[model samples]
Target: MQFLSAYAAALIVFGILDAVWLSIMGRLLYRPTLGSLMLDNLRWAPALVFYFLFPVGVVHFAVLPAFAAGSLQTALVNGGFLGLLAYATYDLTNYATLRVWTLTLTLVDVVYGAAATAIVAGGAYGALRVLASAGWI
Candidate 1:
């Protein structure tokens, strides 16, 4: 139950942060290099589903341990590591298989994913602590 709360909080916080980042930077970062292969319109349903599911793994493997350790640093480091692994898995696989995939995009995404996850995990931990203090969780 506690984990579920943490996950939900993390998802909400991270989703908002990610949405802002994408809205501001996605086109500048991706459209030029991959325009030919880019879909005319994004399939938002699956993309949103991916956002929902990916955080489950992030919260489970990274945030939970950090909470146990009682350290924000742990959350940041572990979350970044896990995020790198996850993004690398997706980006590398696409890079290997898709002719349109660019190394620049892959590298940029891996870095962004790591940083974003670290920030989100740390923020989630802080939010959970605040909630617990307020007797909300």
Candidate 2:
């Protein structure tokens, strides 16, 4: 039903976008394992948690299925703002010190966060518009 499609859409968008970002990260600075990955990724996690949680994920997957219909908006305003803020902070911090490790991690966070927000929001909005036009709203 609607629940399946909504979850499908969100997962598809997030997965593809995160994959691309992770690819870029791996190419540039290599990948971290275990705890280090978590530490490096923290800068972006707050916004991402919101992006996936209590969002279109909630509205589309839960509310829509319950009503046998619904609308979907990715709510990107906050996501974009947070991504930008975190990127700027990381950039400034990295610039001042520019330690190889720190710079690498911050760069990864900045790029990944921005790209993730743009791709996820853009993908979701496009899908929502398509669904809306198809009367899947």
lDDT for each candidate structure: 0.85, 0.54
- Candidate 2 per-residue lDDT over residues 68-102, each given as its tens digit: 33322223543454455656676767567653446
Judged by whole-model lDDT over C-alpha atoms, candidate 1 comes out at 0.85
Q: Please give, for residues 63-109, the per-residue lDDT of candidate 1 as tens digits.
A: 78888888889889988998899889999999999898889989998
lDDT of 2: 0.54
Q: Model 1: C-alpha RMSD to truth?
A: 1.4
| Per-residue lDDT of 25 in model 1 | 72
Q: Which ten residues in a row have the lowest lDDT in candidate 1?
A: 123-132
Residue 11, candidate 1: alpha-carbon lDDT: 95
- Please tell me which predicted candidate would have the highest TM-score against the true structure: 1
